[model samples]
Target: MANHVYTAAALAAAFFLAPANAQASPQAALPSAEVTTAVDDVVARYELPGIAVGVVVDGKVRHWEVRGETAAGSGERVGRDTLFKVASNTKAMTAALLARQVDAGLLAWDDPVVKHLPGFRMYEDWVTREMQVRDLLIHNSGMGPGAGDLMLWPEPNHFTRDDVIAGLEYLKPRWSFRSRYAYDNTLYIVAGEVAAAVGGAPYDVLLRREVFEPLGMDGCRIGEWRISEAGSVASPHVKRQGQWIARQDGEVVADMPMAAAGGVRCSLDSMLRWTQTWLAEEGDTPHSGWLSKKQREAVWTPHMPMPLTSRMREWNKSHFYAYGYGWRLSDVDGTAKVAHTGTLSGMYSAVTLLPELGTGFVILINGEAGEARTVLEQVLTKHFTAPGQNRTVAYYAEDLARERAAPESSAARQSSGAPVADARASAPRSIASSSELAPWLGEYRDPWFGDVSICPSDSGARFESANSPRLSGPVFNAAGRFLVDFEALESDADAWLDFANDSPDGKKQLTMAKVDPDADFSYDYEDLHFRRTGECASQ
Candidate 1:
């Protein structure tokens, strides 16, 4: 078949290209043969335009490699300096810039937002005075879903960072402050502002001088891209219908002085420099004078836990969830993990490290790379635990298998990208017995939120958040009550606690007040619990 030949050629090129140049640089690694096999497999499977992967050990750049083309069909080979929009992984860089301020005694993690951005205030009167720097990075803001998306996304509007801060008056509270871990983006801007206000420099300038410069990320710079500049960037990708499609290029969030979350672009090699710095600071033999051990520890400590612990688990099989300052704290094979992930319209990014394992990794894709977090863990688990273990991201395995796999239902097809999903029709009926499922499923309502229903879905019972994959991963069980609870199931683990559900009336429903994990006023997720039947629907 044409597809089969394409797979073989891709595998051959992916394995032969870099190793041909870096010859044995990768081959010398453990299970070198197997790793080559895995890498080739992934390149062939996904048909990725290109991928820049780096592995760090101790405080040095250990392995760096790339495959395919940066623009796929184009002959543009991904070299050491190939620039990729890192999406949200840029948040960690933003956090590190903030940490530079802490090193100078400029700001404390507990400092209030209004300290630097004088115009800043939360919708909640009580919170405005009490909010802390860590609160914003910790996702405690309760603003409604897509509430702050207005601030950015379809081009950050003409609003300055100050404009976003000023608009908080109109934003409503989704839950009480500190009730749950809600992700938000606006908070990063504030954190950047706090750093800039104290450091006596703009946030972008401070980041370059303090972090980017020292790390030798000279190629790294902040984004102020124009519509015409879209050609310079890799296309952001999302899965639709049954294939990965390139999202149309849109205007870049204007060049704002605020340099806190989700700004900055560079190559995987440059990113590795930052990764090495964090990995060193996170490890025993740290890069001294950049961040004190205590300061770095603070970044890795549990500052907040979102209510949806269930979904965090699917992110990593070995670890439980807990947040550390701006970083999400997870444990793998008994190692502490200070990690963050970013999703921009056209690109996706992931960074993970096993401090105990003396390893850190970063994977970036211009298109939709489904679940790189799990793939990273899978590779690491084999790399360390298995004697002479070797594993790589396989791109074609599933497609090939599914091509010959057994017939699946229409819903299953949708999840896996089958033609059956293309012929959309009536919503599939629920399989769970209505009587037994009814008590657990009901018309539940939250006084502070909208009508939420707990009904059987294709994959069982779940909560939907717009159509964002990151927005909706944790599914809830049918409590048959007004309450909405997150499942402790590994498929959905929160920062802490499995969120063991218990309902006296089994009719209390809780709705998402804030889904932005990158906000300044975000709340801890586990702390949220609701008791209302009129606002949310329970299916």
Candidate 2:
């Protein structure tokens, strides 16, 4: 009953805050009452802390609205300038900065990345030599999904952009070069470095001069230090104990190093400018002349095709899905829709551009609700298609209901943040004893992730990653193989360390895999090939 009341109150608050004061001056097409109802319904269903959506048509922001509070408990209302981490949406901006260099005849789209940054390398020498600047922006780098992400995801480290470049040779390729599309973030970081090298400034500085300043998006910023200094920033929120809790802090990776891939902080006000710039440029209306139409077309042109799941095929009715430089390209209802979704730790954001309609919208949320897609879809369908065509909200609501009602198991509970037999769990019970396990105890290293040591800790034998300190957890035997439970992580993404003696001298090498079926894909434990560097003192 208390939960019911909380839900009602939350919905009421959202309703009250639905039509915020932040409207696009000279609003072109305000969200109708129907759109408001749909947006409010989705927000209530997800119990999001807050969300801001901006709709722009023909280079004019038709509508901009903020719903919900700055956070779950904070009574502070989210205003037009409330800054939110715009994660991978930052990628498009990076591509734009690089495009400016191309516009100046400083860099070419097909120029080999190695030409710009000689130290750049991939797992394969041929791939490293053949990789073009365009390849860095596309997801067809032949690496697996989220490969090398462990270097930055879940925690911050002392890694620099140079470290990211140096670590590339170690990431094993899951596909042949340009053979298929597999989304990755590491290469984008490289792209940022390339832009910085060619532009004679840091990535963020380059963006400011090329993109932000020209558009007058003063509130938009790149590094964490700048984000902290921003006037008003939305607190990132996560659901805990059936309540939305705000994390009123910024992620370290969102600062400078990883900013190239997913770190961008901006508000609805600045994002309006950014989106409007893109819409204007799409219509041959130049703002700062940073990019030529040919360059813009190159960025929007589909570079590589992405496979569609059966559900995705049905959802957008997309015949094919491909990647533009930094944008995702697809056709919806026979109209080309260029889009991208951004997900930080707690913030979820999406930007959609319909060049054909001269329409685009950006939805920024403080919570990681999957329903952000539904909200944006509803808005898009409402404008582009027939009146009764917006059934995405219902479909997503049903999907969430089904997910919530599924029976719970150990794996499911662990995946959903229930306690696991973590590092704090009881010590090892194997008959093989500590001496038998000591052989596996050593400092293991991966090129991208740096180091992960299997060493003695207060909790017993543990596995810890150098780049991601929170990855430290209990290392115990399970099903005859050594396993690790990342107690600090809410998810059940445990790693399995398999030792082999394929060397001529019978030297052992450790290869890790996220054996848990429920592990987060970003964990990418399978990407690490750790050779035992030195023995550790046994626990």
TM-score of each: 0.63, 0.84
Per-residue accuracy of model 2 over 1-539 as CA lDDT, tens digit each: 53543343344333322322222223224446655676777777677789888777767776776888877877888878998889999999999888888989889989999998999989899999999999999888889888888776775566777887898898888779887778899999999989888888888788888888888988787754643467777887777788887776653325557888988888998888887777664334557365676777777766676665555556556565667788887666655677898887788888887655567788889986756656556455545533445554666667657766877777876685443434422345332235556777778776577777877765467787777788877777754667777776654566677888684556578887765544556788878777767777553
Model 1: C-alpha RMSD to truth? 14.2
What lDDT does the true structure give each of the candidates? 0.55, 0.73
Candidate 1 — number of clashing residue pairs? Answer: 74
* Candidate number of the best TM-score: 2
Candidate 2's TM-score: 0.84
Q: What C-alpha lDDT, on a 0 to 100 scale, does residue 493 get in candidate 1?
A: 21
Pull out the clashing pairs in model 2: 224-255
Error (Å) of candidate 1 at residue 484 is 29
- Please report how far candidate 1 places residue 169 from its true position, in Å: 2.5
lDDT of 2: 0.73
